[model samples]
Target: MAIRNMTVATRSLDADMTVDEFKEWLRRFDTDRDGRISREELRRAMRAIRARFTGWRSRQGISYADADGDGYIDDSEVDGLIEFAQKNLGLKIVAY
Candidate 1:
């Protein structure tokens, strides 16, 4: 397996303080004020990153990484997917 050279913020669900922190970040992603993140939101975010980061990766063969298989990336999904949006989208991640 190739080593992914990326600085993704992923926190273990088992660890303290991280799980909650991630949940908060995820909330920002969901702009509809919906309790869960819908696939549309994920797709939009995915596309936005691609537009800014030329050569950015798309949601090509990955499913679970984006969110729950049902289409929503809920609080429960946060624990496992610690990958950076840039890595997942194959784009340059910007913090600002």
Candidate 2:
């Protein structure tokens, strides 16, 4: 996927965004392009969203999402991250 210049602070996630769109947006912070989100990448994402305590939040996110204990949010565990984003980060993501 082509990485856009849009940052979460500049182009906030829309409440109506579909799950795929949300994933695409989140991927922007996947700096290594490893097809997985790391704790540091998630910290950057949280920072872009103006979230406080980004380090703590990122750790919590990874803890919640990394169901395989692999230390990364891979495709299979993305849903858990999405739930964390919604409940903790106040992001609105839809399944449709």
Candidate 3:
């Protein structure tokens, strides 16, 4: 039997905060006040928050959160981002 090493991918949030807190964090990036985060906006936000977003990573993030396939992340899609942060990224986020 051959053993294989599996590397788990994970990202860490800088702090433990609530869903509302997460929303607030997103708001910082939603500059247009359209209640949606554009890919560019998300990129800026990622830079401000973690300072770690390449073009490809930004697009990937947008695609992950943009559940509607609308090319942007609306308020409805925010929860998905929150979930990703909390689950896949190992961030601690409190529920409302």
Candidate number achieving the greatest TM-score relative to the actual structure: 2
Q: Give the TM-score of candidate 2.
A: 0.86
For every candidate in turn, the CA RMSD to the true structure comes to 9.8, 4.0, 10.3
- Candidate 2 lDDT by residue in tens digits, 1-96: 322455567656444556887788789899999999999999998888788999999999999999999899999999999999989988777766
The Cα error of candidate 2 at residue 83, in Å, is 0.5
Every model's TM-score:
0.43, 0.86, 0.72
Per-residue lDDT of 45-74 in model 1, one digit per residue for the tens?
Answer: 444433343223223312545454665666
**lDDT winner between candidates 1 and 3:** 3
Looking at model 3, residue 14 earns an lDDT score of 44
- For this target, which candidate reaches the highest lDDT against the unseen true structure? 2
**Which has the higher TM-score value, candidate number 2 or candidate number 3?**
2
Between 1 and 2, whose lDDT is larger? 2
Model 3, runs deviating above 4 Å? 1-12, 87-90
Note the Cα lDDT for every prediction shown: 0.44, 0.84, 0.66
